[model samples]
Target chain A: MRGLLFSAAICLATSPALSDPLPSWGSTENKSTIISFVESVTDPTSPDYVTPADRIAVFDNDGTLWGEQPVYFQLIYALDRLKTKAEADPSILTSDILRAAAEGDLETVAAGGVEGLLEILAVSHSGMSVDAFQDDVRAWLDEARHPTTDMRYDAMIYQPMLELLSYLRDEGFQTWIVSGGGVHFIRAFAESAYNIPPEQVIGSAGPTEYVDGQVMKLPGIDFVDDKEGKPVGIDSRIGKRPIIAGGNSDGDFAMLEYTTAGDGPRLGILVHHTDAEREFAYDREGHIGVLNRGLDEGPDRGWVIVDMARDWEQVWPE
Target chain B: MRGLLFSAAICLATSPALSDPLPSWGSTENKSTIISFVESVTDPTSPDYVTPADRIAVFDNDGTLWGEQPVYFQLIYALDRLKTKAEADPSILTSDILRAAAEGDLETVAAGGVEGLLEILAVSHSGMSVDAFQDDVRAWLDEARHPTTDMRYDAMIYQPMLELLSYLRDEGFQTWIVSGGGVHFIRAFAESAYNIPPEQVIGSAGPTEYVDGQVMKLPGIDFVDDKEGKPVGIDSRIGKRPIIAGGNSDGDFAMLEYTTAGDGPRLGILVHHTDAEREFAYDREGHIGVLNRGLDEGPDRGWVIVDMARDWEQVWPE
Candidate 1:
């Protein structure tokens, strides 16, 4: 019994909770690597020790933090708006883009590529005050349930990722969302969902014009924050290069490259959706969050590829 | 004699050093109001108490924090670069705008208005990496002296304003520079001169595009941060409205209006240059830092107009 107590005490001291600060993450190499990297950089005596303001960690939103399976959440919002408007006034659907969007034909709508998507967004989102848009988004997020699991879109966010954000914030790091998503869309939920303040979130911005004592979002996207545009968005919004970057798609490849390329101990994490049972798992030819180039190049760049099935004990919050 | 000694001891107990925290500011109504507001907002027991994150204060850069005459310091940098570039390639001066800029024709540049000024900035600032442009601006600021005062341009920053920044920071306010000047240009000196970090400085941006392995400034003005643009820029960069705003020119009138209009006990200050003997003093028809609309509308808006000759104990630092 004495020996058993000693073993229990040793187990308690060496427990994963004591060894790993990231509770939701499993005892995989990816989780251990992340904890070790965070430990090294945060240590005062470590050569890689970075001050709080300089400890910037940028993360991609769509697939990195939440599920992007049934198309992006923003696209879902856009399509629903188009359907409502078309039903109210058929004239508004004179354009093929609106008709396609209203029909939920995403492939045709996406065939227009970035420019076509921006066109649809402009038609669906313009002519409203920022506050009004924010209110509308809030109302939608409140009621909109994911078709796959019947969970509120915000509730579908990764439990492990949320823990990671809290962990980083606890360590005095300023976390930011550098996503290929719309700035207005992400700003609406970033603070409540990720604990990252509005000023820290950087993404593609639509044109905004101030008129009649109100700022209105112009329907056109002035920039794209995907692929190479990721680094551009980071530089434009955040003047400094981030030390840590996390993403789950090829679109985030450039951001990870730009972040980890900087000298010293840097971390680039790619969250590979490998759990087909607990969550939707698709890659490369997948409709959204395609993990193609990142998978091939991650090894070359010393990036940690996180296998969701193996690395995360809890996929979604209970 | 005993009575006189007793009075002296009482006077020592109520010394101004212990009472008035802002020493550089004269014992004026403006200074008192500032202190009182800060005290009320910082005190937990006070009904008007504010959280630290919500205690944001935005200050106009030119004329408010530093001198913007004979022209904006950024314009001066642009013109100097235009001259240097034109000298290297005479053909570069073929453009009418470049010719006018190189000749120091302020009237023509001003007449061309926002578009013309943006055109000039694009010409002067494009085709360089952000780092290169930053280095160029840094080198110029280091060597450049004000023609009028023969003092280093950085040294021309307001002494009383410096004290105010420190005081506000000490009281947990995050002070930001909301300038009509170029962001890249202002970011170079904001940290070193005013202790405002690069991320906190919001200004007009020249066109920036991500290129091969580097982010380059495209030769065009994307957005202007003056007048209505100031409020728009604030909303774009910082989603939260600041409680306190300060400016010195008609250009800042809109920003002051927007900040003070928010729901709260707000403070708006207009720095009026009433000291011609110490510094340049011009109002409605001034070449730069024009102070017209603000002076006329300040009284009705309840904004405290700071008289440079009276409210400030000293203008430039010794």
Candidate 2:
């Protein structure tokens, strides 16, 4: 009986069907759809097959690949930095929004909206070399933990999305991160957390000064890669239309539209934050990553809306 | 006797020494220096060995990779485009510079300086979709010839540089074109001319608007990727410092400085055009690709100044 059990276990281990590429994803329609899309584009015999060089897959960083609850992780880092700066020299916190951010008043800071947040970010994140800023981000990521989950911020990356990224890469798609977050902030952790290189990560950036052989982060927004700017960023950076685009917000609507509108087989995926128990669930009314346009029009556009609760077998990686 | 001759020919064909990677380059110190630099960084046993992901090599487009004699090929294209536009509607040539440009008055247009050239570019280049702009560039490259060389502009690329690009790529380096030319213009032929993909080509760009799923190139320069801006462009686009940088002019001085200043094995190559008999040779006092700063300080900074006439066995590809 023991020999027969061993034989059965060996048979199961070698079975191709059991070797799922996306183990973190449940055997749901969303998972099947994603697999089908990848297979269709990768299979040489398929009519919709795309060349490997043209197979670009882009993902939004904040809400799409990771949790964006209790405000953005970047904002938290900025607030923390602001506090430290205020502790060292109180004169840095000139505005009320800056004061609120420095004081760790989430309510007041959140109420200040994007303009106020940009002001804080420009102040807290600039005046240092790019390398220094990146080092600071790396240090913060290493030390900082989620307020509620207590996990390292980098560890909060979705296991299912990681699996998807790996799967797509395995299928010859060059995975990229197109985010509304700061390029430096995303680049600092993107490689370690998501296995995406800094060159492949595109995001909002500030004007930088090349001084004394160092690129200093200047105190001004160069371009905000959100909403319509996402597509523009995609055009300027990639110089080619992405075959696959994944996001979780209205900010990604234009990107999805632009990607899908391209004359070929393209995939637009919207990660619907449906699992409140596993991750924070907010969309239309959410302060960050609002998805009103996507939610209302995604289905008609043939976009795959992955229900996080129903589709993901696991949220965080083990 | 016939068999002996055949055997000798076979031996010569199979000899590793005969398999020179840079066939277009002469047996010069520049070639050996370039090879040694590549070897040190690529050899795993070497102390200066770099990982494949970090093996980035940036190059300037206009004079470094190809001939930019008389004027930039892009300006020639813009002038040709201006003529066509003027023939259709003369009212479009409102400014003296535009009129001079349309009438092919090189002297008058040249006297107007960079400001005049920019005004002409902004007017002639905008109001078209990026795709359309690229298509126009492609069409121009297909038909346009250098007035002096009488060869197609794309065909005028340096054969030695082509070999160098391929050899570096073979050695696991990601070769990128960081040009002062328009991104759209460079992207059109970069992939075909140099085997460099569009995403790997960084350049100056105008603002773009996303309309009806098409990215429209709007008027006004967003950034000039020359001089100090080269390093800034490298930071924003590539997000990592290059290990190797190649250029022909002072515009590339900052880029070369930034690349070599990074803590690693680095190589800075300046292509000095000294082959007036074969290719136009104008530097230090040339209207385009001025090289006073690079000529003055490049040797002290350990930069390889490749005398084009001496180093290159051939100019244009066969």
Number of the top-ranking candidate, with lDDT as the measure:
2
TM, every model:
0.90, 0.94
Compose the digit string of candidate 1's lDDT tens values, residues B172-209: 99998999888888888888899997788888887677
Structure candidate 1, residue pairs in collision: none
Kindly report which residue stretches of model 2 are placed more than 4 angstroms away from their true locations once superposed: A1-18, B1-18
Tens-place lDDT per residue, model 2, B1-318, is 456557767877875345788998899888999888888888899999999999999999999998888888888898999899889998888899999999889998999988898878887789999999999889888888778778999999999999999988877889999999999899999999999998999999999999989999998899899999999999999999999999999999999999999997889999998988999787899588898989999999999999988999999999
DockQ of 1: 0.37
Q: Each candidate: what lDDT? A: 0.85, 0.90
Model 1 C-alpha lDDT per residue in residues A1-318, reported as the tens digit of each score:
466557667877865446456778988888878888888888899998997778989999998998898799899999888888889888887677778888989888988787778767877788797778888888899988998899998888999999898888778788989888887788888888877887887778788877654678887877688888898777767777888999999999888988887788899999999999999788888668888999998988899998999989998988
Off by over 4 Å in 1: A1-19, A87-91, A112-116, B1-19, B87-91, B103-120
| Cα-based RMSD of candidate 2 | 5.6
Error of 2 at A278 (Å): 0.7
Q: Clashing pairs in model 2?
A: none
